[model samples]
Target chain A: MIQLTDIQRDFQVGDQQVHALRDINLQVAAGEYISIMGPSGSGKSTLLNMIGLLDQPTAGHYQLDGQDVTTLSDEQQARTRREKIGFVFQFFHLVPRLTAAQNIALPLVLAGMSEKERNKKVTQALTQMGIADRAEHRPDQLSGGQRQRVAIARATVIGPAVLLADEPTGNLDSASGIEVVKILEQLNTNGLTLLVVTHDEALGKRARRRIHMKDGLIEHDTLQNHPSLANP
Target chain B: MKTRDATRFAFDALRGYRTRTLLMLLAMSIGVASVLVLTSLGEAARRYVTGEFASLGTNLIIVLPGKSETTGGGSPNLLGGTTRDLTLNDALAVSRSSLINHMAPLIIGSAPVSVRNLQRDVMVVGTTSSLLDVRQWHLGKGQFLPETDIDRASFVTVLGSTLKQELFGAKNALGEWVRIGDRRFRVVGIMAAQGRSFDIDVENVAFVPVASAQMLFNTQSLFRILLDTRSRESIPRAIEHIRRTLRERHQGEEDVTIITQDAVLATFDKILRALTLTVAGIAAISLAVAGILIMNVMLVAVSQRTTEIGLLKALGAPRRQIIRLIMTEAALLSSMGAGLGLLVGQIGSNLIGYFYPALPLGAPWWAFVAAIGVALGTGLLFSLLPARRAAQLDPVQALARR
Candidate 1:
């Protein structure tokens, strides 16, 4: 579950103040699949970063799983992020020097997981992402879709409750984009909470719950039954 | 994060960027190696000088004519005009002191000694038979000059091993009459090869009676009076006695300079030790330059890896973990460089010792410890700015960067 009330984010470019997010309020239940769509600079990404605990709100209240996370210390926030949230960036952000398997094992390593258990989980994630044969490949050595899959595996390998994907398929080709979306959908179907921020209308519409933003404010929030989810 | 994982992560990062790592290693290794090699060279010079002084006999003192003038004064009295000459009588008077053990009045000059068709220009040392005991020299053939009265000009000479070989060939040099500076003197002894004493080649000199040398050199003053004390502890008392005796014999004037053997050694030791530290300090500057290089390189690396740092932070690495990773990388590189420099320095010193066996060049244990400690310290210290920059980086901006 996630909650945000009167969340305001401001940026100072030079002399003038820029409002990136203004008076935003939202709430979502566990295991919900949601998409946040907007034009550039519409505060969609800023909202996702706030929810991911990567940025502090200029003025707001944020609660995650009944804890007021806005009041948490930096260390406690990091721990909460480690234990409860995962982020998949548009750039895939895979450490270029690490192999796909090592990339997926990073969160576990940060959590001080034993090598044996880390290797086991990494292998399972590599298999589940269907990048098992490409486990030894570096990010630069993989195709756009495979790299995104590795990034996704890295995000979800720690089995976090919420997954935040900011344009996960933004850099991929049409087929690869569809495949990544399907993998994300599969995870969501398995009861993982997924919040995707994207500019693609079709991808945004595929979510069960959708929110649209304009001028640093959410203009619409609605739930819809996607035909594919009904059939599967 | 686990230390093992942090270490491996740092190592892998360094390996991924080979040129940066190698450049840092090169700077650090050169710094450490130069410090070691330079200090060893200084150490060897000190050792060589100390060894030479040790060989020049202990508990000894020398009295020279003329006071050593340290200040610049054009006054005639301060010049050599009024300086009293150290003479045989002065040496005899000093010798009578109860604190004195043996005394040798020395007058040194260069003269050609001829034996039949063979002649070689040799340093002539003028002294009594006690010179042998005072210098701790051994006779390879017959006896040293016989001890006679201070006024007696005995026509006796001692041939150094080299001079005897050149003049007498394989024949017995003892009892041979050699012409030295237009005077024929019987050779009473052939000195054993004693290598070098101070700056003079001991094996190339010829020794004669003090009176005979005074006559040959046409001077009433002795060059120096060499004295041995009863024991090491008696040298101070003996020096005071000689000063009083010489002052009494020289119209109540203290014109002669009394130099205790330990004083000369101590002065040289202080000078050379300071010189060594100076050179070592100069070498240490190179280490500072190396540390600056590390700082510059690490600064560049943090910017280059901003995205990676952000990713690590996103994956829940704490600020300390990030610092640990960066610092560990720098620390590992410098320690490896230090290890390499130690090996190179040992090899370099050994090679120097092998070619020139006289200077036993070995870095003192403290040099090794200080070099390594300083290398690691500088490495960590200089990398701190970049590590802090990396740790404090905003994960959002960093991840947002390409």
Candidate 2:
């Protein structure tokens, strides 16, 4: 569950203040599938980043899982982010030097998990992502789809409560994009909360609940009539 | 992160740029090696000078005819500053102490000597038979001058080996009469070849009886009186007894200056030691330069790895962990450099020792320790700014830099 009450974010550029987010209020229950769609500079990505705990609101209150996360210290924010949230960037920011398995094992390693448990978790993540054979390969050695899969594995390896995907299939071909969208939908059907921000209309229409934004404000938030394809 | 993981991460970064890593290592090692080599050379020079002084003579003391001008902390002024005359009788009084082994009354002058056909200017040292013991010079042939009395003039002369060869040309110089300073004297002995020492060449000098020397040089004052004490412990006692006896003999006037060989050696030792430390300090500057180079290289490395740092932060690494990782890399770099430097410096010192075995050129263990310590310290200290920069980078801004 997530709640943002009157969250505002500002950036100062050359003696001018630019408001990136303003007067935003939102609430989401557990196990929700949401898509945020907008043109560039509409602050859709900014909203997703706020929910992901990467950027702090200049003036607002944010509560996640009953804790007021906006008041948390930087360290506490990092801990909360580590424990309950996962982020998938459009760039698939895999450490170029680490193999796929090592990349997936990074969060666990940062958590000081023992080597045996880390290996077990990483192996399981590799198998679940269907890229167990690519575990030994570096990011440069993998295809676009495989790299995205590794990034997804890295994100979900901590078993976080919410998965935030910023243009998850933006760089992939249609076939691979469909494959990734299906995988995200499958995870959502199994009760993982998913919030995706995208410019792809096809991918945006796939979500049952869609939110449209423009000029640092949410233009629309609505639920369309659709039964769960995953359950069907 | 665990220490082992930190180390591995550091090694990975270093391994990514092998050429840059090698260059940094080279710079650090060269700095440390120079410190070690220069300090060793300083120490070797000190020991060499000390050793040279040790070989001059053993437990010997000199009685000069003048008071020492120093305020008790300078070298013994031997040949100058005398206010009163010291005669052979004064030498006799100092030789009568129980701790005195023997005394050689010395009157040095230089004049021309000639045989029937050969002529050369030669240094003339006037001493008694005790010269053989006091100077530690051995006769190459025949006998030295005999001791009858300080005032007795025996027209017998002793020739050094070179002087003998100059006058007699391989013929026997003993019992040969040579004209020296307008007086004809018989050569009683030939000295061995002794190269320059104490500004006197025993091989180029001729010896004669003390009274003969006084008559020839036309002076009554003795130049110096060389005394060998009975034991090392008795030197202080001998000095006290000579001062007392000479003061009594000279009507209670302490005109003669007495100096033990230890004092002259100690003065040189102190001066050379100070010189050595100054040179070592000059060498230590290179280490600081190396430290600056480390800072420069580390600054570049941080910029190059900005994205990686941002990623690590995103993965939940703390700011302190980022700093630790950079510092760990610096420490590893410097430690390896220090190890290589130790090897190079010891090899350089051994080469110097091999070329000139007289200098015991062992770099003091402290020099080795200091070089290594300074190398590691500078490495860590220099990387602080770069590490801070890496830690302060905003994860979003850093990643956006591409």
Candidate achieving the largest TM-score = 1
lDDT of 1 by residue, B224-249 (tens): 88899989999988988988888888
Give the top-scoring candidate (DockQ): 1
| lDDT of residue A98 for candidate 2 | 82
Candidate 2 chain B: worst 10 consecutive residues by lDDT? B73-82
Per-residue CA lDDT of model 1 for A104-218, tens digit only, reads: 9999998999999999999999999999999998988999999999999999999999999999988888899999999998999899999999999888888989999998999
- Please list the residue runs of candidate 1 whose C-alpha ends up more than 4 Å from where it truly belongs after superposition: A14-16, A132-134, A230-232, B65-83, B96-99, B112-122, B138-143, B160-177, B188-194, B240-256
The sequence of per-residue lDDT tens digits that candidate 2 reaches over residues A1-232 is 8999999989898999988888999998889999999999898888987897777899999999999998887777777877788878778888877899988988887777777898999999999889999999999999988998998888889899899998999889988888888878888888999999999888888888999998889899989888355432
Candidate topping lDDT: 1
- For model 2, the superposed segments whose C-alpha errors exceed 4 Å read A175-192, A224-232, B70-82, B102-216
Q: In candidate 1, which residue pairs clash?
A: none
State TM-scores per candidate. 0.90, 0.85
The lDDT values for all models are 0.89, 0.85
